[model samples]
Target: MKTQNFKTITLLLVVFLTSTSMNLMAQDEQERPRRQGPDAKALADKRLKIPDLTDAQSEQIKKIRVKAQQQTLPIKNTMREKRARLTTLSTTEKANMNEINKVVEEIGDLQTQLMKHRETSRQEIRALLNDEQRVFFDSHMQRRHRGKHQKHRRG
Candidate 1:
């Protein structure tokens, strides 16, 4: 009877430890979905091919990206709403091409504005980069742009 009691207690303790560990791991995953380690900034800089990036340059690039996002967010939101509007207009019993066309034009214009802003931001970042860094940055950006824009179109 003592041996049986000992085995049962050991089994329960093992299960409790395993359950607690699993919960702790799950909680950690929920808290950190992205890189927040001390080396995260260093990794990002390396990925950008600017391993020797200065703090000032990093700050400047960050500002440019943030500013561009701020300026483009409204345009993007409007575009999304316009797209929904276009879908609604086109799905009617008597689809109004005229209204749909107007929404399309507005979306196009917003896209143009966004592209211009992005170009400006890119130019600013390029201006801050050295020749070698610029070469890598430009190529990287070109590849990114192609990947982003060509996702919907066949080669």
Candidate 2:
């Protein structure tokens, strides 16, 4: 009888420990930060509350986002490569300032082109919006910018 009681108590303790460990692991996963891909449709949907966008406008926005992403990828890839090269050059025993400067300039040019492309896309999207939508869009953009700045400050 004593041996049977000890076995039962041990079984219950094992079950409790296993459940507790699993719950703790689940909580840890929930607390971890996750990286998410850019979802243009979801973003457009979020803007619906502010501007009350029509179906046509939502479709247009998604198209614009897709086109911009397509166009920007090459420039972004080139810039990333140039940055990597710069890092490699700087870490070498005989670092070449001239080559590093050139790569930096190229990266700047690429960045400028990327910004211009984005601005053009923004203008095209804005042209599709009505006056009320434009006002809300501008306010929404300002809020987003502020939120980004606040996040940077906190981090």
| Per-model CA lDDT versus the true structure | 0.88, 0.87
Candidate 1, residues 1-155, lDDT tens digits: the string is 99999999999999999999999999998976456778887666666776467889999998898999999999899989999998899989998888888989998999999899989999999999999889888888889889988886865
Output the worst ten-in-a-row residue range by lDDT, candidate 2: 32-41
- Cα TM-score of candidate 2: 0.70
Off by over 4 Å in 2: 1-44, 47-49
Q: What lDDT score goes with residue 31 in model 2?
A: 86
TM-score quality measure for candidate 1: 0.71
Local lDDT at 20 for model 2: 100
The candidate that wins on lDDT is: 1
Once model 1 is optimally superposed onto the true structure by TM-score, how far is the C-alpha of residue 95 displaced, in angstroms?
A: 0.6
Residue 76 C-alpha lDDT in model 1: 93
